[model samples]
Target: MSTTDTSNSPITNRRRGTLQLWSRTLIPTLREAPAEASTPSHRLMLRAGCIRQVGAGVYDFLPLGMRVLQKVSQIVREEMDAAGASEMLMPAIVPIELYAGTKRDVDYGDLLFKLTDRHGRDAALGPTHEETVTEMAKGSVTSYKQLPLNVYQIQTKFRDEFRPRAGLLRGREFLMKDAYSFHTTVEGDGGLNETYDRMYQAYVNVFTRCGLDFTVVEAEAGPIGGSASHEFMVNAETGEDTILVCPETGYAANVEKCEIGDRDWSFDTDATTDLTKKHTPGMPGIDLVAEHLGVKPEGMLKTIVFAKIGGDKRKYVLATVRGDHDVNEGKVRDVVGFPIALADEKEAKEAGFAIGYVSPRMAATRDDTLLVIDPDATGGVWATGSDEKDHHVTGFIWARDLGADLPTKDQQGGKIRVADVRNAGEGDPSPRLPGAKLVARRGIEVGHIFKLGTKYAQAFDFTVLNEQQKKTTVIMGCYGIGVSRTIAASIEQRHDEWGIIWPVPIAPYHVVITVMDPKNDEQSKLADKLATELVEAGADVLIDDRNERPGVKFKDADLIGLPVRLTIGDKALAENCVEFKLRSEDGKGRLVDIADAVKETLSKLA
Candidate 1:
């Protein structure tokens, strides 16, 4: 069997650019995924030989993975260009000083991969280029005419994740497409708002083209300090984040930012009883205390103490929620109107708090302490800490025990502040629609867009001249898309027991030509002819011409998951036809005339 040695031929090289032969490729598919590959996408990527882990939270993209990445990146590039964002590159090593000026260095904390340069100066790998890009604008963009300029880069980012799991979904080192836009105003034409909308649409187009079932939800701009933000989440069963959606009004938000509607939070006057101390030895958690008292968690108050981040150490806020509900620290921060951290047990103890047995009434023991209770926690007869070791207060009623401290209505100005400072959950009423409850869905966030306002502009001194010839700080916006994570997310959303069913647009190759007998001249000639035709028809073709059995070739084709597959065998060709299959479809596929191979493949791809 003399196969043509065209590995270096000019025509072969040209075809190799988009048409790959299985014999010349480097796919090392594993029969079984490793135990450490926890997620479906992680397991499949490993078994399909798309990536190999090099270190914790880091992986090397194999050839197949690189092709998928290139295709996804190209889609991003085209959409960004169409949205008027100019592509630019920034250095990966950023000086620590840039972040120090914005105080984000402290915000990033250990997440920044800090290093000492040769000159003894501090530097770090760029996690995001907001500071660098803002500094650049401060130096060059000083005129109103240069306003509303958006520049972006497709680059690698590093974050020191405490635990990077789920493959590329949450990696310490990964590829990202981050874009920054500078504007003179916020809402007018060619301003930050306009540019933000354009970028949002571009993201929609990009993800849509990549074939993701996603939802755009209101989100909190954590650490980035933006006024407004939204996250594009790809729906997945094994996603890390919980998304709450309102079926009636189409309002959706991540659990961290979702709001709860009005509930019947009136105090249960009939259930009120004298607050009496009861023994609850060794019961530190709400669940433990509730279990000890033979009461439901919903009828208990869970008080958590927090100290202001930059305020007096002795001063604390007692954040209380229903035992069944969890306090949202973000909502607590907003109610407190400052940054706060969970109070250290030692410091809390020193401040007259019982620590484990601390209760809402602990606010009365210290002049500096404030009580903030979630509305749901303010109504029911509750079991709470007794301000002493190994004791709890049973029959705790808000109106009777707390008295004047408990607000008459849900407001912040009272002695006992009441607010919706708890995380929303499934069946919780939607804040936007009356009588409609919030639904839950798991999602993987793929893109985020933020209206940054002037947070970075002010920090970096980025300003521009207004029409009045006066200097004004530029309004800025930040947008990010997880370039590599999208691949894993796509697999998470589209994979089956057989293998990944890659989307047509982002598949490593659009079609795989499986030759049942590569050594046979008839089968080999048919594969070459069909591959050339498909390549000319603008489809990436991978010819399975390796000396493998028919079953092996078919399995490999399904495992790699090209969008379309064409099988050429002596039996099929003897009937002047070939097997046409779609990887996304079930069954072995129907026979088609050999002459119609290219046309049918292109139709399936389209």
Candidate 2:
């Protein structure tokens, strides 16, 4: 958790000199990686001997690979500390009892990597440690004085992903820095909100200092069940994610919660014409049906099938958005006022609703009926399902002739109904900033932070007595950084055909000192001088002292892409100089005297 212990670690000094430029520690380079590696990041990372596949979505990190991992972790640690967070270690193998109390053991279910111990008790490789951390706090801390406690750990997490690819970017087993904060209230004054904003600011600094070009976007808390969450994404062409962004205002968020521009349509209860049925053969879909009827997209109706909780089978919801527009499921959920999943076709058939032929009039007219009409779906006379095969009802009014009132089927008294249940598309407007419409970008998640509220604390009874001595659950927030994925992400952001271009702060070695044809005393001597000087100048240097050909050494040098390279060759000796190469340079190197070259390259790295 702290660097003080690193000084005494076995490999800190003992193995530093043993690593050879071409022979050991790492494979140096592989001529070819497997064809399965689609992106440069996956190929280079494998060819560089940083990682190897152990399972479909799991990896084994080699020594040099772990050294870079530590450097990345150290940066995260410093940033978390700067934000006044305390560091702790949590076990990778966690007991299921902790999650049982949170009632999320089943929530995780198949996504959890569960195994039984010798004693035959269920345990899991922690995907994140909210349950463990809150349980630990519950057993020890109780006073309100300890109301705000922040703890974090850099640990390996596991998930049972259905499909895994893109190397470490979405692996089943990977490294994560997850932190959870406990508070006493939900208000921004002093509780979960203060910590949430603090965590957000801390995340900004963490990604910034890591040399990562990242953006924080609004996201769902997902199975973790939190009120709000944000995802840190690195923009890259090879990225696996697609985010909707506003190019005009720099507004961005995941597709799930993206907001759109304004378009309103509402009709009084007495507006629509008489409900008349008409033939609409071969009109299985809304688009085809609208075209068959000589109607614009906005002049038609669309119904979706969804299974609500406590329902016997999937039911039809005749949500009438403008024909040109799409449905936002979140709005439908807001109408139902709870979490629900869409009902598939089989369930719809069992509910006696024709798969393709469904109408507002045909659906069961009861309090339990879900009929949510969009603002535009209400006032307009439109064409919709006739509930019979190859037929439709036109000039159908939702509120006026249909006796519907504002997304409710309770006859204006009993229960709210469900209307639309489809996902919104790219044309939607900005929910946050005005004049900003949704734009698109590919993103890969690098980090995430969530306001957990009292979910974990209340589960474990992790509480503190308020001023009046009333027992109250502590509010919570959780933060995470994809440590292993950062390596793959960095390569995704900074790489070319040659090899990886790492940012300075996390590069394994600052400089590579190549003694081309080291058998020559002159070249060896000059290389040694440069290596020593650069090391003393506070640079981590890799010295190529092997008796290899000049071509081999040069090839390896460029292939590894150390930020700076120094060559002490016969040509340099003749000029009383050394060839100075900046690996990222666009042109040939310059010759400087051996002594001056060391300081010169060091300056470039600085």
Candidate 3:
């Protein structure tokens, strides 16, 4: 007897039957989450038996979790396809040499998971595929005909996180939907910008379809190395990222990229107190020194030293800001137009500079040392480092102490520059609105899109012939959606104290039929009938047929947080009705006739 080919047969197209029996599936709900589960989503994921921890930063998505993942993936696929992007898959393991051009191996540091294959060749589990995708475009896409093509993949990515404590929010291995677009130009129709805008809208649609309330904020590309980027954030109190929002102007940005508006700084120039040096032993940090001198932190100057990454001649930068603020290294790097790192203790000391007490006047100590002061720090008569060990200078004004030293022109030969180099905080003036203040809000970053502007194209030499038949480097854009992180972030935003309140689109099942007394034939028969009707009406249904108490069944239904719930019991079934409830609402559900149970459940789901 020969077996029929079922792979291409109609049997494959048949539904696996949307009705899932509670006893037939594995959902081991727990009374408490593990000790390591700190975040709300992490705890709820464990309690609901959606996921189980295999190791730190590694998890096994149970049946219920897998269903949700599939739903999310499908939505992403639909949106991406609708946005004119082709879907493809790439290998998870990549050769280490591919990272040579961008030097992301060094940029990623220990976060890139390095490994050696059995052939003794060095490889890595890709944290991202920018290099790999660009290399692909370089080989086959040699003409403008293939220009403006966007390709994407929904696959697993690995990162060697030092401490991945927030479950799927920061995991070693997680699913992602990453897309790369290649184009010959940046503006106009069918250009990189046009494709980028489409992808941005697609991202908005994906998250919105997933029932996520998110905000799009200006963001730094970080190690991704792009000209500009934006992040889609889900607002939550337990989120890791801090977003600064201008209430009046409706402008929002992540803390790292937030800009501050103009501000007034009053100087006490009439004090006439001479600049005096004082002994301050064991007070190296700004806090300790400020305490010893009895001055507020805002009235003190904090100087930091940084070394430029590459050049024939060594160059150092002295960045000074108010003690109350922090130096934003990204802004400093942008101002200098190069990569920079904090000067090591030995490097600073070897250059005839005090490690902690290097003052703004130290810029005059060496020709290669350039001072960059925050604009707000220029007017005040502040306390600052004296370039001497265990000592500080009091009553030091920038104009009085370094009048001729502050150069008018920005250069490296013993001159000072002024710019905004400090992190913008909660109440800082908004860059968009004149007098509005930026408010602080915590948000989880679920998606990011970048205008790469030939960064990866140059690395891979990915050039295509333009309309003029001349070779030109391709401009690129990268868009990413954190597939697994979205699930966790959704839980963070939608869960209640009782359990997760999954939205309709991504909920494991649209409706759960709770059999109050599974042993009763009437209750079981009614549940099965209602589940079948609901499934036929385009709703995923789960029937609770386990030999558990009615209270346990009700609690499980609430804990899993299906969008709609239908209860079949001795009392309700005898009355030819069932209790209909929506997980988002409070208190008990009203009765619905058994004849209209399926419609009522679908309506609730809608």
Candidate 4:
């Protein structure tokens, strides 16, 4: 594929010329949003005539939406090229065999949109291009001389979302700018880290240029297994993911990967008494049981049984945390080093374990079972299950009742293990700043960069001969930005009740020449002259020459969300001045001399 170098390109100089409203363009504004639209971006896009739903989780971008999308793609392309990356296109439909090498076909599960061709061959839409890119690298590049190569593509992707909603935020079919970097080794300068850093900065530039209020936080790699990854999230109240931030320490992370910093834990062994079992009638939940036992929920141990499956082996693992806390399945998976599922009641019963009343004593009794205990649960005297129906154990000390072989200072020893396996709660210690507390906020993920060492390279055997003439697998880094979603995210971050307030860099047109009535020769002449001068001044201009009321034209101008609006009416034009207003600012339009209109618009755009 051929690549374009856009480093010297100007943002305001669009390839297309000036647009004329009512005749040359379409802006089908709606008074109310469609019922399916939920988020502000979704509702606004529908009302502004930027997009229309073709099916569930599928949308057709109208001219206005396409313009915004193209602008975003161009910015991404320029940034990638500036970072010394090449552009290439990959097929949207990939053969199923390509994914077989990486086992992503199974890993992606139902999310993979699989299909059967007429010749009875298996095919699937590309949800991601890691495997395909690695396969391509294997055939084309053969030595370290071709190392440190970064290639990117802006293309459509497909995923079979279980419940696709929130319009472009979680669409089934969407546009994405995905880049992959290959390196001969991960260590030293000018290696994987260098390329990864460049991509990271490129992503930062992309979001910032789009005028998004976003943050970079440590994130879980998920299906894209990697040593490290960071997600770029646009901050918003209605975002789906929770972001943990420590103000004092400048530490931030997604909840999935966030860690609680150091804190002191003191166990009141002086107030503890002998362990005793009491008869309880029913299987009440933790809150009810805490009330029954006259103890706080934190003074109880909540034991959960999980069945870990790897290859052909399935082992039942018991996980214990404070009753007030919840288990983080991802952390447990990491500890067990395998995929896990909640143990069914039947399976627990068949394994000689009580469904809800299982105790830590079972871990001591069975050598085959694995045990994981949260760090908070290690030094506390607490209420616990007695391993019998209708019975509870009170004052159960971790050291005494559980055989007292517990390792001091929070380390795995004997059969019991102590780790930070529960989800970090609000007010937990900040990992980066001592004595600082972690706070939670919501954000929408717009981009992700992963350090995907040799996972894909080894799968596809993408190797190169090093300087020493040794065959070495290529290390990789994958970075992605949702091109269309970035547009929606911008709206999510920068919109008011009136409409979207677009940023100057990516706005469809830098200025909108709103002529009240094109039939009026004075207004038409002024609007046409202003547009010509603005285009010459390095601004994309849109002339609203429609024969409509001033009120309707003004309303449409706001809805369409051009960065600047120049209103040319008989009143303003007769005064030898036109009203100029910025869409992002409040209040009435200010009158500027018609002779100075182009100069004023150019300055505002700058």
lDDT of 2 by residue, 195-273 (tens): 8788899888877877889877878654344448899999887787778887777767776656555644445544446
- The alpha-carbon deviation from the true structure for residue 451 of candidate 4, after best TM-score superposition, in angstroms, is 1.3
For candidate 2, the lDDT comes to: 0.73
Best by TM-score: 1
lDDT measured at residue 281 in model 2 versus the true structure, 0 to 100: 78
TM-score of 3: 0.93
Checking candidate 1 for backbone clashes, the offending pairs are: none
Comparing candidate 2 with candidate 3, which one achieves the higher lDDT? 3
**lDDT at residue 600 of model 4 (Cα atoms):** 86
| TM-score of decoy 2 | 0.83
Error of 2 at 117 (Å): 1.8
Least well predicted 10-residue stretch by lDDT in candidate 3: 1-10
Candidate 4: where are CA atoms >4 Å away? 1-17, 221-227, 272-300, 307-316, 333-346, 378-400, 410-412
- Total clashing pairs for each candidate: 0, 14, 0, 0
TM-score versus the correct structure, for each prediction? 0.94, 0.83, 0.93, 0.90
Q: How do all the candidates rank in terms of TM-score, highest first?
A: 1, 3, 4, 2
